[model samples]
Target: MPISDFRKKKLLYVFNVFFDVNQSGTIEKKDFELAIEKICTLRGWTPNNPKYAETHETMIKIWDGLRQRADANKDGQVSVDEWCSMWDDYAQNPDRALEWQSRYMNFMFDLEDASNDGSIDVDEFTTVCSCYGLQATECKTAFNKMSKGKEVVSRDEFQELWKQFFSSEDASTPGNFIFGKTNF
Candidate 1:
């Protein structure tokens, strides 16, 4: 099945706002490296830390998976067109993409769960988002929407949202804010 317009918009938002970490208009190794650096810095992780090593390894794996699956031209980068094309195929059965997507979802959630309590509070969410170049105010607002007034969002709840973010077509779903609001 083809990707819906709404899903396309969401995907574009992710590609433009999140994946293109260096504002280079494409997804590349450097972008992933920059993201890993930012996340490591936010977590106060260094080369000597286990967490840093694990995070770095996971991100590189993700980058490898993405390049393998999405770099249609094998040019060492994923262009926006290729990104949409890959996601269009995945939209047919989101579950097929779960192997890689779940890795990313868990990585993100763990990164935000700085308290290591298996839940993400607004402050933790905001800090991580800010490291990604998002405004703290926007991150806070997005957190409210995502958490649905809960003091903290548990891992299960976040997992559901993560699934929704990848599969749901409804605009009202809180998962729409998973990476914060997209400017349409």
Candidate 2:
């Protein structure tokens, strides 16, 4: 499914964090140098901590994959043009994209899954949405619908719902609850 520019821009900005690490408005190899520490913090891990070795490794893999795809020229860096074009990074490989999408969702889950129970409750969901600067209450209805009375969202639920949120034209798809505002 084709993604809207608005959403693409939003997601792009998220990706931009890695490339624009120095906030210079462009992606360079140096930007990735700080990724390990940042990714550790994002995953609630401490750098040089062995307990998080696995998670940290996965994060590195993800970053490596992004760099490989975005740095198309193999010139050791990805400029804004190359970074924005990252939308097509996996366009030719839906299965691979799906796998990456699962990891993306896992990262989101890790961010919001404070309980570490492998699911997101209303409070947890609200907290994650709040981080995006959206009003927490605004997503209650959508969360309710997505949770379907389950009161929590599992990994499978989040991944599938997120995919829909990324591509589904259906207004009722649970993906809309992701940010609490799907008007875009």
Candidate 3:
């Protein structure tokens, strides 16, 4: 689905608030690197782990995706102006964003779907949710809610939840629990 103008504007604000980890007035490489590190630490995904290489690679790919899509000046960072401009451009020409966003979501789903079973179970959900510093019990409950007793989440369902997570205003939405606080 294409991002609507309101959603695009909202997302621009959300990105700046959430991703400017350094609070340096810009989204820089250091900020991204720090975020990746914090995620790995929170998840206890370390270099010594068997899945470390794959996890590290995915993080790198995510950073690259951000830079490739928005680092307008090629300065390895995204200023507020650059970030807003990028989203404004995307809002006018949303087709391009759809492709990139779809690819990113697919890549994330594939990475977390370790069994390649076309769906994600509790374990898979835990793996993805770990980065958010969520407790196992909390994640399990959230997964149950999102799964609605199916005990597995299909790709389409996950995509819908992803969108909901980003755009929904309702505080109690199931997708809101998939990661950290959505209200912020």
Candidate 4:
């Protein structure tokens, strides 16, 4: 099935607000590189650090995957239309969606687990969202909703929420807030 308007908007919000780090109107390698730098900077990882090198490799791999999968025109960038269309395909094949989205989900959860406690507390979620330019209050609210009254979100719970974020069409679903305010 085709993605709903709300789903399209949410995907676009993710693309424009988060992944398009360079504000280049499309997602390109530079966006991933910039995101790597920002994330590494936030994590205090220096070039000599193994984690920094790992981050660079991981982000580049993700960029290559996205470019190969979503860049239908082979222009080396993913535009909003291509993004939504790729997601539409995913929507039609949920198993494939889960498989493809798992890597990103794990990366995000691990990144958000700043304390390395194997779970994401509200403060950690808030901090990550804040880094993405979301309001602290909004991040707190989103964490509360996504966590569903739990003190922290476990990896399993986060996996479920990640699936919902991509698959659920309902606007009121808690998973919709997984990335903070969706604006739709």
Candidate 5:
């Protein structure tokens, strides 16, 4: 099927956002936000209440996945080399692309496991954000907004989010990796 204009635009927007954030060869949470805001604004996606804190908090949750993949070393920071490693691997092998996606999803689950006892909590939410390049204070604020009255995302919920965020129509491209469809 030929791609629809709307889908094309959305895909382009997604690529643009990722390109902008990775332009410096480093991914920072703030830059990630800027990219998201630009795309969201272009798509006219307003939050339920349009609160900056709430929006930022939600974004932190999303960033948790990508940041974890980029970190590679689990050092709480994404270095340029780590970022390059991710991009290179994805570029060279379809299997590597799928592997990265799985790793990212796994990291999200791990980060949400709070209590050090294997449960999700507010602190873990904050830690997830900080791991992505947000300052501690910023992460704390975002975590507060995100964790307010919300239960930890279940495994099913996590998988759903993973598919929603990563699925693409270009799954048939022989050399291009579609996040969930590509088996690695």
Candidate 6:
């Protein structure tokens, strides 16, 4: 059977993530964050500040949205089977492709807000790092040194720092597209 457009795009998104992390054979927080950033750029949306993105309230909102689709039975939580089913359904809905895309983008931001709090904390930072198979210690160290008065990293500060972290020498060259190279 032919795949639906929605499913095709969803699969593409997953494939992109898998391809990026295939070298490590695990999806880490960095991988997830990169994927989210890429998706946001494609959609012309600005990603949340990394320092404050993983708040409990934000996470809760994100989890609630995902649960709404993943938990068809109105359960408060999603089992592995339910999650898989939602993923499968998303991959196959050509008719609602745009809606699915929107949901996926929203979910990424929500996931970053790991704590379900309105604000992100150090623990949330660690959780995000854990997802990317990276140590949060470095982030913690940097954050501690920089944050003198504020408990949370402001959006502007985080964005400026995140840019420095992700920037590469070749990043300035636009449209230097290479075919068949899947890793972004």
lDDT of each: 0.84, 0.62, 0.65, 0.85, 0.47, 0.41
The RMSD (Cα, Å) of candidate 6 is 14.1
Q: How many residue pairs of model 1 clash at the backbone?
A: 0
User: Model 6: per-residue lDDT, tens digit, 3-99?
Assistant: 4454344334344433234434333334444555543443345546553443323434544565566656664544434544555554454234334
Once fitted onto the true fold, the runs of candidate 6 whose alpha carbons sit more than 4 angstroms away are: 1-19, 24-110, 116-118, 145-149, 167-184
Model 5, position 14, has a per-residue lDDT of 34
Better of 3 and 6 by lDDT: 3
**Candidate 1 displacement at residue 96 in angstroms:** 3.4
Candidate 5 regions exceeding 4 Å error are: 1-25, 49-59, 72-77, 91-184
lDDT of 4 at 8: 82
Ranking by lDDT: 4, 1, 3, 2, 5, 6
lDDT of 4 by residue, 1-184 (tens): 5678888888888898778999999999999999999999989999999989988988888888888899999998999889888877776766666333667787889899999999999899988888889999989988988998789999988988876777788877878888978457
- 133: Cα error in model 3, Å: 2.0
Top candidate when judged by lDDT against the true structure: 4
Which window of ten consecutive residues has the lowest lDDT sum in model 4?
93-102
Please tell me which predicted candidate would have the highest TM-score against the true structure: 4
- Model 1 residue runs over 4 Å out of place are none
What's the distance in Å from true for residue 70, model 5?
1.8
Whole-model lDDT, candidate 2?
0.62
Residue 144, candidate 2: how far off, in angstroms? 5.0
Model 6, position 140, has a per-residue lDDT of: 56
lDDT of 1: 0.84
Local accuracy of candidate 5 as per-residue lDDT tens digits, 48-108: 5354444456557656765777778776556655654554444344333454466545545
| Superior by lDDT: candidate 3 or candidate 4 | 4
Report residue 19 deviation for candidate 3 (angstroms): 5.8
Residue pairs with backbone atoms closer than 3 Å in model 1 (clashes): none
